[model samples]
Target chain A: MKLWVSPRAPSPRRVLMFIAEKGIGDVELASVEIGRGEHRSAAYLARSPLGKVPVLELPDGRALGETRAICSYLEGRHPEPNLMGIGFEEHAFIEAADRRVEFYLLGTIANWIRHGHPGLAPLEQPQFPDFSAAQGRKLREVAGWLDGELQRQDWVAGKRFTIADITAFCALEFARGLMKFRPADEGFEALQAWRDRIAARPSAKAGA
Target chain B: MKLWVSPRAPSPRRVLMFIAEKGIGDVELASVEIGRGEHRSAAYLARSPLGKVPVLELPDGRALGETRAICSYLEGRHPEPNLMGIGFEEHAFIEAADRRVEFYLLGTIANWIRHGHPGLAPLEQPQFPDFSAAQGRKLREVAGWLDGELQRQDWVAGKRFTIADITAFCALEFARGLMKFRPADEGFEALQAWRDRIAARPSAKAGA
Candidate 1:
């Protein structure tokens, strides 16, 4: 199976981080240049209807989009040292936590960049500074909330390191690059520490 | 196990439709009054940090939020009729299709409602009319894309009926109530027919 990804993308980094965590090195890689509008080409659209990066091409020639779905699929095939979850209940909670980070933290950052960043002006039809600023405020608010949550638990979904952590790490990293968001200065002591711990992982740098 | 949901919610309705399809009647039901802000109570917040409904409370006191997660968890435990998928490869594609509906069609509709609907004024602080209007246009654009996809297939995710159908059904139903969007009137003949077919299922009404 070949993985279609853009090195600069956040979503593709998610899949890469997961693969690095699993210590899997055999998967082939095919880069899609997002900067040149390669992802919007007809060839890329055939693989991903949304024409987005980070698609996994199955051996059967079927392409799979969405980072979570592809990660879960990999988890299903490679069950050992499980990163998603262990059983039904664990999977449910982990997914819930993952979605929480996604909908609140990651979603806010994404909206900010898509609508606020000048570099992406060509991508978003009509950029809205007001809307982008609103999302930025949401980012700060959600970050504060996450700081409190991290004050209580070690990981986003309790003890073990999971996909939830990976998501937050990548999202926060993206925020750092796009919005100049610094967790420590934002009064997110716990979250800042968690970020450092997650960043120290070999996969974190390997994927980058 | 107990299911906490609001009758009028779109996400909760997705889980309900899935339960209806699975013919699972033994699950206990608990209603959260979102209009009255029952979901924001201390008790509910303890279960769900986001203070949203449609959480599946496990017997062990674990509460699972996110409709897809709960539905997938249930599918993991039940594994009959194979609504999610039959195997690893199938599961990946079904998930890919599900996320596509979620990120594009459903996400746009939800944003338009949350940001534009006056009934939700209490929920979304300082709503932006311009942004909301932008999302509304996106709703129309994505609906048109879906109409084209449905023109060639019997179901949302290719030929087989899956959870993707339930998600789109609930999402479009929400739009119908909120926006009065009639697929037939808008030249979405294929999508209109698909909606009717999904609505005819016994499970569609059972959970609703």
Candidate 2:
């Protein structure tokens, strides 16, 4: 199997981290340069109509896009270190948490970056006129919410180190690069510690 | 099991259609009026922090949000009439297609509606200030893309009806209430006919 990825992308990073956690290094990597607009090319579009990255091309040549779907497929195929969940309720919990992180945290962060960062202006149409202010506010709001959620748990999905953690961790890290996380905020103590712990994972370092 | 849903929200409609498709009426329905801001209550937030509707509370008191996840859980519990897929590769294909419909079609449409509609002005605060115009353009782009994709297949996931089709059909119907599909647009004939056929389904009628 070959994974088509872009190094600078958050979605592809999620997949790389999952592959690292699975300890599957035998898979080939096909790099797509997003800055060069390679993802919009016809060849890449054949693999993904949305022209996004982190597309997994199976041995049979069929390509699977979507970071979550690809990750889910890998989890099903290699169930040793379960990233999704072990049982039905666990699965549901992990999925619910995962969606929460995606829609709430990651989605907000990505939109902020896409709309705020001048470097990404060309990628999105009709550039957001008030990018910086909007993004700053969104980032603060999302971080506050995520930090509050993290304060009550050891991980994103309660106890386990599931995909929800990975999703949230990746997004949080991505946000940290663009903006500073308020360490003084009482709500984020657990979240800050969790970030450090997750960052120390072998897979996290390897994927990076 | 009980489903917490709203009357006009598309996400709940997805689950309602799934329930109707599976002929499962044992699940009770609980309504939440989104327009009246019932979903924003502290009680509702405890159920789903995102404050979205279509939360399926299980018999065990665990709630599952996100339409696809709820559908997957339902499919797992009721596997006789499978809506996901039959085999591994089929599952991958269905999931991939479902994600495409979700991210590209439904996601875009919802963004357009929530951000663009004056009726939803309260919800557009920090996320989108002038969301309507951008959302309108996004909705058109996705509809055009779906039209092209539909030209090459019988269903959204090829050969059989799956969750992808359900999501797309519901999204398209929802879009119709917002903006009409342009029949004059070339290559949308198949999509138009397909829409008519799916709209005729008893499940579609019953859920709507």
Candidate 3:
């Protein structure tokens, strides 16, 4: 199986981190250059209908595009040291946690950076400064909430590290790199600490 | 177990339809008036941290939020006539399909309507017409692509009806109601046909 990835993108990094966390190997990596519009090429479009990066091409030659889906598939394939939950109940809670981070935190950061960053203008179609600013404010609100959650629990999901942590870490990393965002600077010490802890993980540097 | 729901909301409706599809009748329904600001009440916030609709209160009194998570939990509990998928491979394919519909179709429609519609002014913090217009155009582009996909497959996730269909149907229904969008009117016959087929299902009117 081959994994099509764009090195600089966040979603592809998610799959890479998951693979590393699970200690999975033997998967071939194919790079797609987003800057040069390689992802928009006819062959790439056939692989990922929406022209997104980080598509997992199955042994049967089918392309699976969603980051969460690709990770879930990998988890199902390699269940040792599971990053998703064990049972139905745990699955529900972990998924809820991941969705919360994905929707409010990561989703907000992506929207804010995409619309606000000058470097992303080619990708955003047309930048909306006001909307981007609104998303920025919303991101801070959600980040503050996340900081509180981290204070109450060790991982993004709960006591144990999971896919949710990978998601949140990647999101904050993106913000730190592009938005120059820092939780500690905004009085979110707990979040900053959590970020530091995750960054120490070998998987954190996966595909960096 | 009680399901907290707001009737007019798309996310809540997604859960309702899933319940109906699964033929699960033991679950009790609790209403939250979103228009009356009841969802913002402290009591409601305790049940759902983000105050989003369609929260499932477990028998142990834990509130499980996020529509997909809730549905997955229910699917785990009731496996007959599965909506997610059968195995890891099918699950991956189905999830990829669902994410495509959710992110491109439903997400775009929600953004467009939230910023464009007058009645939604209360929900959207500050409306941006340009962003709304951009989202509307993106919605059309996605819907057109979905129309082409439907021309090739019978269901949203292909072959059998699944959660992806439910999600796509809810999204299209929301557009039909709020945006006055008709796939056929916009020259998307396959999408219109698929919509009509799903509408004929008893689950389509489950919560409505």
**Candidate number achieving the greatest lDDT relative to the actual structure:** 3
Candidate 1 residue pairs in clash (backbone atoms < 3 Å): none
Question: Which pairs clash (backbone N, Cα, C closer than 3 Å) in model 2?
Answer: B112-B135, B116-B132
RMSD of each: 1.7, 2.2, 0.8
Cα lDDT computed for each candidate against the true fold: 0.86, 0.79, 0.92
Worst 10 residues of 2 chain B by lDDT: B178-187
Superior candidate under lDDT, 1 versus 2: 1
TM-score, each model?
0.95, 0.93, 0.99
User: Whose TM-score is higher: candidate 1's or candidate 2's?
Assistant: 1
User: What digit string (tens of lDDT, one per residue) describes model 2 on residues A3-120?
Assistant: 9988757888898888898887667999999889999999999988878888999888888888988987887777768888775667767888888888778887787777777777
Ranking by lDDT: 3, 1, 2
Q: DockQ numbers for every candidate?
A: 0.69, 0.51, 0.84
Q: DockQ ranking from best to worst?
A: 3, 1, 2
How do the residues B68-185 of candidate 1 rate in per-residue lDDT, one tens digit apiece? 8999888987777688887767887788889889989899888888889998787778787778788889877788889988988888888799999999988888888888877898
Best by DockQ: 3
Off by over 4 Å in 2: A181-187, B126-131, B181-187
Candidate 1 off by > 4 Å? B206-208
- What TM-score, to 2 decimal places, does chain A of model 2 have? 0.92
